[model samples]
Target: MTTTLPPTHRALVLDQIGQPLRVETRPRPQITPGTAILRVLTTGLLSYSREIYSGSRKYSLPTPSVPGNGAIGRIVAVGPDATTLQPGDLVFVDIYIRGRDDPTVAALSGVHDGHTVFSRRMMHSEWRDSTYAEYARFPLENCYALNEKRLLGSPSEGGLGYTVEDLLYLAVQLVPFGGLRAIGVDMCDRVIVSPATGAFGSTAVQVALAMGASVIAMGRNTETLEKVRGFFGAAYGEDRIQTVPITNNVEQEVAGLSRFGEADVFFDISPPEAAGSSHVKSAIMSLRHSGRACFMGGQREDLGIPTFYLMRRNLTVKGKWMYERGDVVKLIQMVEAGILKLGQEGGARTVGRFPLEKWQEALDVAAERAGPGERVVFNP
Candidate 1:
């Protein structure tokens, strides 16, 4: 927490393609006048690393890019103009996404010319040199002020008593909550969210219920369906929030749940693939003349929705992504206020933790079927 803090630290650096990241001592990242030096506490992996390295997402940075996105840490040094943060401040910083253009970070992150507007504020990060390190630098705008006392204290002392295992759940929940918010999912409107067992699907159910919508959750697992109904409450109950069992006849199931022919909003969070695409197409065919549907999962292939149906029905299609800075802050506050319960509300739960060295394993767990609720994580 001082200027004389060690000048070098270990970072998980990705030096090239098709290679595992290596831990190496690098010059400790410096805090600019409007930036902060963060000693990362935990960082969550986004599933985008492969695309980042392959140059598939055009938005990805060049090689040697750092491979982290979400992180929570403590501020150890603060530059001038970084008045909102001080030494020892517990914070959550998004490393993948660039901060809003501010002169202080431009030079540090190599956007010094100010000519690259998109690079200055884009969501891509230098995945080759990220938070997998002992310490990292963050732009003031990219950093968030967390409830330090509450986050780090004992549960007995009013801390949420949470662990890093809570990240995926938090992320999934934020997806629907933030995504629905992006398109205005209002209360009391009918809603149908499908594939309710996946993280995003479960999140859509809880988010819709929280926003006062009557959610119709669909999934193949009977137990997961029951769990969804129970958690949303019997008052908001299974009847109002029923789950349709997915099968060969997904279209029939969707048509059955959409009796009113359409809901206020429809969510498709399962992997975007053949079965998933058909379900969405069916939802569109059966959606009310003016309803909206959102695609909330990663794109697996091209979505070939019927243009005629969308055009004729006046249905809006939207693609959802990670939370925006403002939305992330709002969600963090919701968690602090006890409004969003990560594990209970359908976020991933930790079944194991490893040192930063096992980041690949952690990623595998996150990518696997991963049991019913297991989320493997790394603590730096």
Candidate 2:
């Protein structure tokens, strides 16, 4: 799938923080050793991206850097020893590309930084992390090739086999997928995804459901909740996937959700508006003894939990980062084996789209609470 390398291309550059992305024509990066170029197809507008744009989360990157972390595109050229990834291949641009390689680190410490996980940022170490451009360049390892008819049926089936958008949706799902794995979500667990039905919340709900756990989804909108409910069938009926709308008395029922059996995993991805003093309190109180809770994504206020509950409940609380190569591969395997279900077979839907030029509108929509089964994407 190799093609003639273009000299220049259009990109949405973040020259300054808290400012709108400006369209600019920049030099198309040339491929060096261990590198490849991706013609940006469509990148998702995740909540984190908006945070970076707003100058809230200070990334290690200095000013004038591209703000995107995840996207889906194709490799148009390859460098030395990078023969494994070819041109015209549909692949996912992982936001964080850090995984440890030093034998000593793996031998001594079981954990190592994986954006070491190639970030999808346009300016990662003098390389390109900006997928908002018409052309993006990155190390071969940062890109994971997507192939497998099972997960991606033939083109007409609303699968990745045809359009690149489906592949982007699959890539977006990896964020929560990685978090769930870190929290040890299993079939026997009762998972509660707070503020469910957004980019991360919706993805987590579906992944938990596929893993055989009963999901109690908490969201703010009834329409969005209904869309999540449509993802599954009678696999335990309504009891299997319970949707709760966020309200003043939300805690009354959230505390009772444990009645179906204590919650095993709680994903706190609640947005700012729905977040208040009660958010974390209800989440912690609802969990059973020794439950695992992950404060993954989303904005929340400083929450105070009773010290007695922390010590008595035997709860394991932790934070989640991004995914690894293994996580992405696991998602791919699930799709291929016909185990995971996406939009093609009636899962979620891409509700909004905007080209690179309309990044402002796209960012606004993505930042807004996404409607049920609706996700805003950037077609660069």
Candidate 3:
């Protein structure tokens, strides 16, 4: 219960690493002890955020900093070790902080400084300011809550009318729903999402078809893989979605992912210009023997794993990062049980909407609509 207390706001600082993002005025974050205080409304504008603000991705981010990361707010204030959270609730901040006594010490607030020395002193001492700002604070377990009468109430009152820029596609669907829940994608599983079509592999082919799995989606962008198989094949169907193309030719991409069948999970996020892409060993040789793989991309080379065919196909590879606060509370309960649709029924579409002094035309329309459900927000 704390809302009337401004004492200064507006931000977007950055002041270092090739500088040029001022906007100033600060001073509004004041709730410490397991923090809380937000009001940020909508923030996501990543598309490589100009290679992490022009130092060309050296990214340790600890400048005069405010930058930005996951947001979508309205808590206003909550410290004293907040329990159920109050003062207007409508959360989802999670800039992946971690380190309340070493959760292997993490940090991503205002975007990464994490690479240990205790995650670069927890991103140069305690989550260095984020969410571009109009009031932010964070921590309190990375602030999750978000149902606000079924997302901004309406649908004749039963709500789900959604619109906080369609919850900014939960920051691009929480990094492929944390690598398809770290390769345990179940329900009718057959998964395969390779390069799927960028912007987090076309939202990991719509979060592996909203976790009910049945995708194949690979990529070399054959018309954005048939616009991601006609926008998630008209709501998860067209035989549960399939589209291959990445012909770097590992046996013609394992015979085009074995003409769609033996997968059972093989996610691969691939992107560091997909280093030596053979579509990640033809989706780990088209999965299936006890199958499973996850590899959340940004590919820093050397992923040539064929190691005796994953030890004779007992497969199961892992490597997930950036998720688990119960995967942002099960991705907002899979978007409030409507099974994951958000804005334009999940193929998203904001394309641009800045403020906070048009953050360089919102990072150039988030790098020219980064693709796959292109959204580019700010509204701070």
User: What are the RMSDs of all candidates, in order?
Assistant: 4.8, 5.0, 17.2
What TM-score would candidate 2 get against the native?
Answer: 0.83
When sorted by TM-score, best at the front, the candidate numbers are: 2, 1, 3
lDDT of 2 at 164: 62
The 10-residue segment with the lowest total lDDT in model 2: 103-112
Regions more than 4 Å wrong, model 1: 1-3, 46-61, 96-128, 151-159, 164-169, 220-240, 248-250, 259-261, 272-276, 343-347, 369-373
Better of 1 and 3 by lDDT: 3
The C-alpha TM-scores of every prediction are 0.80, 0.83, 0.35
RMSD of 1: 4.8
Instruction: Give lDDT: candidate 1, residue 32.
Output: 67
lDDT scores for all predictions?
0.63, 0.68, 0.82
Per-residue lDDT over 265-288 for candidate 2, one digit per residue giving the tens place of the 0 to 100 score: 888766555446354666677888
Tell me the lDDT of model 2 at 252. Answer: 75
TM-score of 1: 0.80
In terms of TM-score, which candidate is strongest?
2
Better of 1 and 2 by TM-score: 2
Report the C-alpha displacement of residue 373, candidate 2, in angstroms. Answer: 3.0
Candidate 2's displacement at residue 379, Å, is 2.1
lDDT of 1 at 113: 15
Clashing pairs in 3: none
